[model samples]
Target chain A: AQSVTQLDSQVPVFEEAPVELRCNYSSSVSVYLFWYVQYPNQGLQLLLKYLSGSTLVESINGFEAEFNKSQTSFHLRKPSVHISDTAEYFCAVSRPGGYQKVTFGTGTKLQVIP
Target chain B: EAGVAQSPRYKIIEKRQSVAFWCNPISGHATLYWYQQILGQGPKLLIQFQNNGVVDDSQLPKDRFSAERLKGVDSTLKIQPAKLEDSAVYLCASSLVDSGHNEQFFGPGTRLTVL
Candidate 1:
Protein backbone atom coordinates (compact mmCIF):
# COMPACT_ATOMS: atom_id res chain seq x y z
CA ALA A 1 0.00 0.00 0.00
CA GLN A 2 1.17 3.55 -0.72
CA SER A 3 0.16 6.92 0.68
CA VAL A 4 0.79 10.46 -0.49
CA THR A 5 1.13 13.43 1.83
CA GLN A 6 0.66 17.01 0.70
CA LEU A 7 1.85 19.25 3.52
CA ASP A 8 0.15 22.39 2.31
CA SER A 9 -3.61 22.44 2.02
CA GLN A 10 -3.62 25.93 0.55
CA VAL A 11 -1.01 28.15 -1.09
CA PRO A 12 -1.49 31.83 -1.93
CA VAL A 13 1.00 33.63 -4.12
CA PHE A 14 0.96 36.95 -5.89
CA GLU A 15 1.15 37.02 -9.66
CA GLU A 16 4.66 36.37 -11.01
CA ALA A 17 5.74 35.03 -7.64
CA PRO A 18 7.33 31.64 -7.17
CA VAL A 19 5.47 28.83 -5.45
CA GLU A 20 6.11 25.29 -4.31
CA LEU A 21 3.63 22.60 -3.35
CA ARG A 22 5.30 19.98 -1.21
CA CYS A 23 4.46 16.30 -1.58
CA ASN A 24 5.87 13.16 -0.01
CA TYR A 25 5.06 9.49 -0.35
CA SER A 26 5.50 6.34 1.68
CA SER A 27 5.78 3.13 -0.30
CA SER A 28 7.60 -0.15 0.11
CA VAL A 29 8.54 -0.35 -3.54
CA SER A 30 9.67 1.95 -6.30
CA VAL A 31 6.75 4.03 -7.57
CA TYR A 32 5.71 6.41 -10.33
CA LEU A 33 4.77 9.95 -9.35
CA PHE A 34 2.39 12.33 -11.08
CA TRP A 35 1.00 15.82 -10.66
CA TYR A 36 -2.49 16.74 -11.81
CA VAL A 37 -4.05 20.16 -11.87
CA GLN A 38 -7.74 21.05 -11.73
CA TYR A 39 -8.91 24.51 -12.61
CA PRO A 40 -12.16 25.91 -11.30
CA ASN A 41 -15.09 23.81 -12.57
CA GLN A 42 -12.79 21.76 -14.77
CA GLY A 43 -11.57 18.22 -14.61
CA LEU A 44 -8.09 17.24 -13.55
CA GLN A 45 -5.40 17.30 -16.19
CA LEU A 46 -1.98 15.74 -16.07
CA LEU A 47 0.67 18.32 -15.38
CA LEU A 48 3.79 16.15 -15.29
CA LYS A 49 5.03 12.73 -14.37
CA TYR A 50 8.20 11.00 -13.21
CA LEU A 51 8.47 7.47 -14.58
CA SER A 52 12.08 6.27 -14.78
CA GLY A 53 14.55 8.41 -16.66
CA SER A 54 15.93 11.64 -15.24
CA THR A 55 14.78 12.64 -11.78
CA LEU A 56 13.51 15.95 -13.10
CA VAL A 57 10.23 16.24 -15.03
CA GLU A 58 8.49 19.28 -16.43
CA SER A 59 5.13 20.39 -17.76
CA ILE A 60 4.58 22.63 -20.73
CA ASN A 61 2.98 25.22 -18.46
CA GLY A 62 6.31 26.06 -16.78
CA PHE A 63 5.77 23.77 -13.82
CA GLU A 64 8.34 21.17 -12.79
CA ALA A 65 8.87 18.48 -10.23
CA GLU A 66 11.89 16.46 -9.20
CA PHE A 67 11.79 12.91 -7.99
CA ASN A 68 13.96 12.78 -4.88
CA LYS A 69 14.21 9.14 -3.94
CA SER A 70 16.28 9.72 -0.84
CA GLN A 71 13.83 12.31 0.42
CA THR A 72 10.71 10.51 -0.79
CA SER A 73 9.42 13.75 -2.22
CA PHE A 74 8.06 15.02 -5.57
CA HIS A 75 7.36 18.66 -4.89
CA LEU A 76 5.77 20.75 -7.65
CA ARG A 77 7.31 24.15 -8.32
CA LYS A 78 7.00 27.01 -10.70
CA PRO A 79 9.31 30.02 -10.82
CA SER A 80 6.54 32.42 -11.73
CA VAL A 81 2.80 32.00 -11.54
CA HIS A 82 0.05 33.75 -13.45
CA ILE A 83 -3.39 34.61 -12.17
CA SER A 84 -4.78 31.85 -14.37
CA ASP A 85 -2.68 29.36 -12.46
CA THR A 86 -5.11 29.38 -9.59
CA ALA A 87 -6.24 25.78 -9.25
CA GLU A 88 -6.08 22.65 -7.13
CA TYR A 89 -3.11 20.34 -7.39
CA PHE A 90 -2.94 16.69 -6.50
CA CYS A 91 0.03 14.39 -6.13
CA ALA A 92 -0.33 10.69 -6.83
CA VAL A 93 1.77 7.52 -6.62
CA SER A 94 1.57 4.04 -8.07
CA ARG A 95 3.67 0.94 -8.40
CA PRO A 96 5.85 0.52 -11.48
CA GLY A 97 4.17 -2.65 -12.67
CA GLY A 98 1.02 -3.21 -14.73
CA TYR A 99 -1.72 -2.81 -12.15
CA GLN A 100 -1.44 0.88 -11.56
CA LYS A 101 -3.38 1.14 -8.35
CA VAL A 102 -2.80 4.83 -7.71
CA THR A 103 -3.00 6.62 -4.39
CA PHE A 104 -3.56 10.34 -4.14
CA GLY A 105 -2.90 13.05 -1.58
CA THR A 106 -5.46 15.33 0.02
CA GLY A 107 -4.64 18.09 -2.51
CA THR A 108 -3.39 21.67 -2.33
CA LYS A 109 -5.44 24.61 -3.54
CA LEU A 110 -3.25 27.18 -5.29
CA GLN A 111 -4.45 30.77 -5.34
CA VAL A 112 -2.54 33.08 -7.66
CA ILE A 113 -3.54 36.56 -6.59
CA PRO A 114 -3.24 39.17 -9.29
CA GLU B 1 -10.98 13.25 -29.65
CA ALA B 2 -13.87 13.51 -27.27
CA GLY B 3 -13.09 13.50 -23.55
CA VAL B 4 -14.73 11.40 -20.90
CA ALA B 5 -18.35 12.36 -20.42
CA GLN B 6 -20.49 12.04 -17.28
CA SER B 7 -24.20 12.66 -16.96
CA PRO B 8 -26.21 14.85 -14.60
CA ARG B 9 -23.53 17.34 -13.67
CA TYR B 10 -25.28 17.68 -10.35
CA LYS B 11 -27.57 15.32 -8.46
CA ILE B 12 -29.52 15.88 -5.30
CA ILE B 13 -31.03 13.03 -3.34
CA GLU B 14 -32.05 12.15 0.17
CA LYS B 15 -30.33 9.65 2.41
CA ARG B 16 -31.26 6.00 1.76
CA GLN B 17 -32.27 6.90 -1.77
CA SER B 18 -30.96 5.19 -4.86
CA VAL B 19 -29.12 7.02 -7.58
CA ALA B 20 -27.14 6.15 -10.65
CA PHE B 21 -24.54 8.06 -12.63
CA TRP B 22 -23.42 7.36 -16.17
CA CYS B 23 -20.12 7.77 -17.99
CA ASN B 24 -18.95 7.55 -21.57
CA PRO B 25 -15.21 7.23 -21.98
CA ILE B 26 -13.00 8.27 -24.83
CA SER B 27 -13.65 6.57 -28.15
CA GLY B 28 -10.94 3.94 -28.03
CA HIS B 29 -10.00 3.82 -24.41
CA ALA B 30 -9.84 0.30 -23.00
CA THR B 31 -9.67 1.24 -19.38
CA LEU B 32 -12.16 3.11 -17.23
CA TYR B 33 -12.12 4.30 -13.65
CA TRP B 34 -14.58 5.61 -11.09
CA TYR B 35 -13.45 7.88 -8.32
CA GLN B 36 -15.01 9.58 -5.35
CA GLN B 37 -13.88 13.09 -4.50
CA ILE B 38 -15.03 14.58 -1.27
CA LEU B 39 -14.80 18.27 -0.55
CA GLY B 40 -11.21 19.39 0.12
CA GLN B 41 -9.86 15.96 -0.81
CA GLY B 42 -8.32 14.54 -3.91
CA PRO B 43 -10.17 12.01 -6.04
CA LYS B 44 -10.05 8.51 -4.61
CA LEU B 45 -10.22 5.47 -6.86
CA LEU B 46 -13.28 3.41 -6.20
CA ILE B 47 -13.25 1.07 -9.18
CA GLN B 48 -11.21 0.27 -12.26
CA PHE B 49 -12.36 -1.70 -15.27
CA GLN B 50 -10.36 -3.22 -18.06
CA ASN B 51 -12.79 -3.72 -20.87
CA ASN B 52 -16.00 -5.16 -19.45
CA GLY B 53 -14.31 -6.86 -16.52
CA VAL B 54 -13.38 -5.27 -13.26
CA VAL B 55 -9.68 -5.02 -12.57
CA ASP B 56 -9.81 -3.47 -9.12
CA ASP B 57 -12.58 -2.46 -6.74
CA SER B 58 -10.99 -2.78 -3.35
CA GLN B 59 -11.98 0.68 -2.20
CA LEU B 60 -15.58 0.54 -3.32
CA PRO B 61 -18.30 0.10 -0.74
CA LYS B 62 -19.74 -2.96 -2.46
CA ASP B 63 -22.61 -3.14 -0.04
CA ARG B 64 -24.13 -0.01 -1.45
CA PHE B 65 -22.09 0.89 -4.50
CA SER B 66 -22.26 -1.12 -7.69
CA ALA B 67 -20.77 -0.32 -11.10
CA GLU B 68 -20.86 -2.00 -14.47
CA ARG B 69 -19.39 -1.57 -17.91
CA LEU B 70 -21.32 -4.06 -19.94
CA LYS B 71 -19.97 -3.33 -23.41
CA GLY B 72 -16.69 -1.90 -22.17
CA VAL B 73 -17.26 1.55 -23.64
CA ASP B 74 -19.69 3.20 -21.27
CA SER B 75 -20.28 2.59 -17.59
CA THR B 76 -22.79 3.25 -14.86
CA LEU B 77 -22.31 3.46 -11.11
CA LYS B 78 -25.24 2.94 -8.79
CA ILE B 79 -25.56 3.58 -5.10
CA GLN B 80 -28.43 1.96 -3.24
CA PRO B 81 -29.58 3.22 0.11
CA ALA B 82 -27.10 6.04 -0.09
CA LYS B 83 -25.81 7.68 3.04
CA LEU B 84 -25.23 11.28 3.88
CA GLU B 85 -21.52 10.65 3.70
CA ASP B 86 -21.97 9.76 0.03
CA SER B 87 -22.34 13.43 -0.77
CA ALA B 88 -19.43 14.14 -3.05
CA VAL B 89 -18.37 14.35 -6.67
CA TYR B 90 -18.16 11.13 -8.66
CA LEU B 91 -15.58 11.30 -11.38
CA CYS B 92 -15.06 9.13 -14.42
CA ALA B 93 -11.71 8.72 -16.11
CA SER B 94 -10.28 6.75 -18.97
CA SER B 95 -6.88 5.76 -20.30
CA LEU B 96 -5.79 4.15 -23.51
CA VAL B 97 -4.31 1.33 -21.51
CA ASP B 98 -4.03 0.24 -17.93
CA SER B 99 -0.35 1.01 -17.52
CA GLY B 100 1.65 2.82 -14.92
CA HIS B 101 2.93 5.45 -17.32
CA ASN B 102 -0.27 6.21 -19.19
CA GLU B 103 -2.16 9.37 -18.36
CA GLN B 104 -5.84 9.25 -17.42
CA PHE B 105 -8.37 11.72 -18.85
CA PHE B 106 -11.06 12.80 -16.45
CA GLY B 107 -14.67 13.94 -16.83
CA PRO B 108 -16.23 17.00 -15.26
CA GLY B 109 -17.74 14.78 -12.57
CA THR B 110 -21.21 14.45 -11.07
CA ARG B 111 -21.76 16.30 -7.86
CA LEU B 112 -24.10 14.39 -5.57
CA THR B 113 -25.70 16.25 -2.72
CA VAL B 114 -27.37 14.08 -0.11
CA LEU B 115 -29.74 15.78 2.24
Candidate 2:
Protein backbone atom coordinates (compact mmCIF):
# COMPACT_ATOMS: atom_id res chain seq x y z
CA ALA A 1 0.00 0.00 0.00
CA GLN A 2 1.11 3.51 -0.82
CA SER A 3 0.30 6.65 1.13
CA VAL A 4 0.96 10.39 0.89
CA THR A 5 1.52 12.77 3.76
CA GLN A 6 1.40 16.56 3.68
CA LEU A 7 3.02 17.89 6.84
CA ASP A 8 1.41 21.29 6.85
CA SER A 9 -2.32 21.81 6.91
CA GLN A 10 -2.00 25.55 6.28
CA VAL A 11 0.71 27.90 5.15
CA PRO A 12 0.52 31.69 5.06
CA VAL A 13 3.09 33.75 3.24
CA PHE A 14 3.33 37.36 2.23
CA GLU A 15 3.00 38.26 -1.40
CA GLU A 16 6.29 38.00 -3.33
CA ALA A 17 7.73 35.68 -0.67
CA PRO A 18 8.87 32.14 -1.25
CA VAL A 19 6.85 29.20 -0.01
CA GLU A 20 7.11 25.46 0.26
CA LEU A 21 4.51 22.73 0.80
CA ARG A 22 5.97 19.52 2.05
CA CYS A 23 4.93 16.13 0.75
CA ASN A 24 6.21 12.64 1.52
CA TYR A 25 5.10 9.24 0.33
CA SER A 26 5.75 5.56 0.93
CA SER A 27 5.63 2.91 -1.78
CA SER A 28 7.27 -0.41 -2.39
CA VAL A 29 7.44 -0.06 -6.17
CA SER A 30 8.12 2.72 -8.63
CA VAL A 31 5.76 5.68 -8.33
CA TYR A 32 4.42 8.76 -10.07
CA LEU A 33 3.98 11.99 -8.17
CA PHE A 34 1.70 14.94 -8.85
CA TRP A 35 0.69 18.27 -7.44
CA TYR A 36 -2.75 19.76 -7.87
CA VAL A 37 -4.31 23.09 -6.99
CA GLN A 38 -7.98 23.67 -6.30
CA TYR A 39 -9.82 26.93 -6.29
CA PRO A 40 -13.06 27.54 -4.47
CA ASN A 41 -15.94 25.79 -6.20
CA GLN A 42 -13.62 24.37 -8.84
CA GLY A 43 -12.13 20.97 -9.41
CA LEU A 44 -8.47 20.20 -8.80
CA GLN A 45 -6.15 21.10 -11.68
CA LEU A 46 -2.81 19.49 -12.31
CA LEU A 47 0.01 21.77 -11.23
CA LEU A 48 2.98 19.52 -11.99
CA LYS A 49 4.03 15.89 -12.17
CA TYR A 50 7.12 13.69 -11.70
CA LEU A 51 7.21 10.46 -13.65
CA SER A 52 10.59 9.18 -14.82
CA GLY A 53 12.65 12.18 -15.77
CA SER A 54 14.96 14.31 -13.72
CA THR A 55 14.13 14.55 -10.03
CA LEU A 56 13.12 18.18 -10.44
CA VAL A 57 9.91 19.04 -12.34
CA GLU A 58 8.38 22.45 -12.96
CA SER A 59 5.03 23.94 -13.70
CA ILE A 60 4.40 26.77 -16.12
CA ASN A 61 3.02 28.96 -13.35
CA GLY A 62 6.30 29.39 -11.52
CA PHE A 63 5.86 26.33 -9.32
CA GLU A 64 8.22 23.37 -9.06
CA ALA A 65 8.64 20.13 -7.12
CA GLU A 66 11.65 17.94 -6.52
CA PHE A 67 11.33 14.20 -6.22
CA ASN A 68 13.76 13.11 -3.53
CA LYS A 69 14.10 9.37 -3.70
CA SER A 70 16.14 8.88 -0.56
CA GLN A 71 13.97 11.12 1.56
CA THR A 72 10.77 9.95 -0.16
CA SER A 73 9.68 13.53 -0.53
CA PHE A 74 8.23 15.64 -3.34
CA HIS A 75 7.99 19.13 -1.94
CA LEU A 76 6.46 21.98 -3.95
CA ARG A 77 8.17 25.32 -3.99
CA LYS A 78 7.96 28.73 -5.62
CA PRO A 79 10.52 31.50 -5.33
CA SER A 80 7.75 34.06 -5.16
CA VAL A 81 4.02 33.89 -4.80
CA HIS A 82 1.14 36.10 -5.83
CA ILE A 83 -2.15 36.75 -4.09
CA SER A 84 -3.85 34.73 -6.78
CA ASP A 85 -1.79 31.73 -5.79
CA THR A 86 -3.86 31.24 -2.65
CA ALA A 87 -5.57 27.91 -2.99
CA GLU A 88 -5.77 24.37 -1.66
CA TYR A 89 -2.84 22.26 -2.79
CA PHE A 90 -2.86 18.50 -2.87
CA CYS A 91 -0.01 16.03 -3.25
CA ALA A 92 -0.76 12.68 -4.78
CA VAL A 93 1.08 9.45 -5.64
CA SER A 94 0.40 6.47 -7.89
CA ARG A 95 2.35 3.31 -7.20
CA PRO A 96 2.86 0.78 -9.92
CA GLY A 97 0.74 -2.41 -9.94
CA GLY A 98 -2.44 -3.02 -7.90
CA TYR A 99 -5.39 -1.02 -9.16
CA GLN A 100 -3.08 1.93 -9.74
CA LYS A 101 -5.08 3.94 -7.25
CA VAL A 102 -3.68 7.43 -6.82
CA THR A 103 -3.59 8.31 -3.17
CA PHE A 104 -3.76 11.98 -2.15
CA GLY A 105 -2.65 13.92 0.86
CA THR A 106 -4.90 15.72 3.31
CA GLY A 107 -4.09 19.02 1.50
CA THR A 108 -2.39 22.27 2.40
CA LYS A 109 -4.18 25.58 2.17
CA LEU A 110 -1.82 28.25 0.94
CA GLN A 111 -2.84 31.75 1.95
CA VAL A 112 -0.96 34.48 0.19
CA ILE A 113 -1.29 37.79 1.94
CA PRO A 114 -0.50 41.26 0.71
CA GLU B 1 -11.59 20.22 -24.95
CA ALA B 2 -14.25 20.23 -22.27
CA GLY B 3 -13.45 18.75 -18.85
CA VAL B 4 -15.36 16.22 -16.84
CA ALA B 5 -18.87 17.26 -15.75
CA GLN B 6 -20.95 16.34 -12.68
CA SER B 7 -24.54 17.23 -11.91
CA PRO B 8 -26.38 18.61 -8.86
CA ARG B 9 -23.70 20.77 -7.50
CA TYR B 10 -25.24 20.49 -4.06
CA LYS B 11 -27.79 18.21 -2.44
CA ILE B 12 -29.15 17.91 1.08
CA ILE B 13 -31.01 14.88 2.32
CA GLU B 14 -32.03 13.23 5.55
CA LYS B 15 -30.22 10.22 6.91
CA ARG B 16 -31.69 6.91 5.76
CA GLN B 17 -32.83 8.56 2.52
CA SER B 18 -31.48 7.61 -0.88
CA VAL B 19 -29.66 9.90 -3.31
CA ALA B 20 -28.05 9.71 -6.71
CA PHE B 21 -25.46 11.78 -8.58
CA TRP B 22 -24.47 11.98 -12.23
CA CYS B 23 -21.25 12.41 -14.14
CA ASN B 24 -20.19 12.97 -17.76
CA PRO B 25 -16.59 12.50 -18.70
CA ILE B 26 -14.62 14.33 -21.37
CA SER B 27 -15.18 13.25 -24.93
CA GLY B 28 -13.20 10.10 -25.79
CA HIS B 29 -11.97 9.51 -22.25
CA ALA B 30 -11.62 5.82 -21.59
CA THR B 31 -11.28 5.83 -17.82
CA LEU B 32 -13.52 7.17 -15.08
CA TYR B 33 -13.35 7.31 -11.30
CA TRP B 34 -15.55 8.14 -8.31
CA TYR B 35 -14.17 9.55 -5.10
CA GLN B 36 -15.57 10.63 -1.75
CA GLN B 37 -13.92 13.49 0.05
CA ILE B 38 -14.76 14.21 3.63
CA LEU B 39 -14.24 17.61 5.18
CA GLY B 40 -10.63 18.49 5.83
CA GLN B 41 -9.48 15.20 4.33
CA GLY B 42 -8.13 13.78 1.13
CA PRO B 43 -10.32 12.30 -1.56
CA LYS B 44 -10.85 8.53 -1.17
CA LEU B 45 -11.44 6.69 -4.39
CA LEU B 46 -14.56 4.56 -4.17
CA ILE B 47 -14.39 2.99 -7.57
CA GLN B 48 -12.63 3.11 -10.95
CA PHE B 49 -13.80 2.01 -14.37
CA GLN B 50 -12.22 1.33 -17.71
CA ASN B 51 -14.82 1.83 -20.39
CA ASN B 52 -17.90 -0.08 -19.22
CA GLY B 53 -15.95 -2.56 -17.17
CA VAL B 54 -15.12 -2.32 -13.50
CA VAL B 55 -11.45 -1.91 -12.78
CA ASP B 56 -11.28 -1.44 -9.04
CA ASP B 57 -14.01 -1.07 -6.43
CA SER B 58 -12.08 -2.21 -3.41
CA GLN B 59 -12.93 0.79 -1.26
CA LEU B 60 -16.56 1.13 -2.23
CA PRO B 61 -19.10 0.27 0.45
CA LYS B 62 -21.06 -2.09 -1.75
CA ASP B 63 -23.71 -2.60 0.88
CA ARG B 64 -25.03 0.93 0.35
CA PHE B 65 -23.22 2.42 -2.61
CA SER B 66 -23.51 1.50 -6.26
CA ALA B 67 -22.19 3.03 -9.49
CA GLU B 68 -22.29 2.30 -13.17
CA ARG B 69 -20.84 3.57 -16.43
CA LEU B 70 -23.26 1.65 -18.56
CA LYS B 71 -22.29 2.69 -22.08
CA GLY B 72 -18.67 3.46 -21.29
CA VAL B 73 -19.46 7.17 -21.32
CA ASP B 74 -21.60 8.99 -18.75
CA SER B 75 -22.05 7.44 -15.34
CA THR B 76 -24.12 7.60 -12.15
CA LEU B 77 -23.61 6.81 -8.47
CA LYS B 78 -26.31 5.94 -5.99
CA ILE B 79 -26.39 5.59 -2.24
CA GLN B 80 -29.20 3.92 -0.33
CA PRO B 81 -29.89 4.60 3.33
CA ALA B 82 -27.29 7.24 3.55
CA LYS B 83 -25.52 7.75 6.84
CA LEU B 84 -24.18 10.92 8.42
CA GLU B 85 -20.68 9.87 7.49
CA ASP B 86 -21.71 9.84 3.85
CA SER B 87 -22.07 13.59 3.94
CA ALA B 88 -19.20 14.73 1.83
CA VAL B 89 -18.22 15.89 -1.63
CA TYR B 90 -18.51 13.19 -4.26
CA LEU B 91 -16.05 13.84 -7.04
CA CYS B 92 -15.86 12.46 -10.55
CA ALA B 93 -12.74 12.31 -12.67
CA SER B 94 -11.84 11.01 -16.12
CA SER B 95 -8.61 10.19 -17.85
CA LEU B 96 -7.58 9.59 -21.45
CA VAL B 97 -6.25 6.15 -20.59
CA ASP B 98 -5.45 3.76 -17.76
CA SER B 99 -1.71 4.00 -18.07
CA GLY B 100 1.32 5.13 -16.11
CA HIS B 101 1.06 8.67 -17.48
CA ASN B 102 -2.63 8.98 -16.79
CA GLU B 103 -3.65 12.50 -15.93
CA GLN B 104 -7.14 12.44 -14.51
CA PHE B 105 -9.21 15.56 -15.09
CA PHE B 106 -11.65 16.21 -12.26
CA GLY B 107 -15.14 17.63 -12.29
CA PRO B 108 -16.51 20.14 -9.85
CA GLY B 109 -17.69 17.76 -7.14
CA THR B 110 -21.26 17.36 -5.93
CA ARG B 111 -21.56 18.24 -2.28
CA LEU B 112 -23.94 16.03 -0.31
CA THR B 113 -25.15 17.01 3.12
CA VAL B 114 -26.98 14.33 5.04
CA LEU B 115 -29.00 15.59 7.94
Against the native chain B, each candidate's TM-score is 0.99, 0.98
Q: Rate the local accuracy (lDDT) of all candidates.
A: 0.94, 0.94
| Tens-place lDDT digits, model 2, residues A61-104 | 99999999999999999999999999999999996544588999
> Individual DockQ of the candidates?
0.81, 0.63
Q: Is the docking of candidate 2 incorrect, acceptable, medium or high quality?
A: medium
Reference-based TM-score of each model: 0.99, 0.98
- For residues A7-70, could you state the per-residue lDDT of candidate 1 as single tens digits? 9999999999999999999998989999999988878999999999999999998999999999
- State each candidate's chain A TM-score: 0.98, 0.97
Residue A81's lDDT within candidate 2 is: 99
Deviation in Å, model 1, residue A82 alpha carbon: 0.2
Scoring model 2 with DockQ, what do you get? Answer: 0.63
Give residue B111's error in model 2 in angstroms: 0.4
Worst ten-residue run, lDDT, model 1 chain A? A95-104
Q: What lDDT score goes with residue B3 in model 1?
A: 91
Model 1 CA deviation exceeding 4 Å by range: none
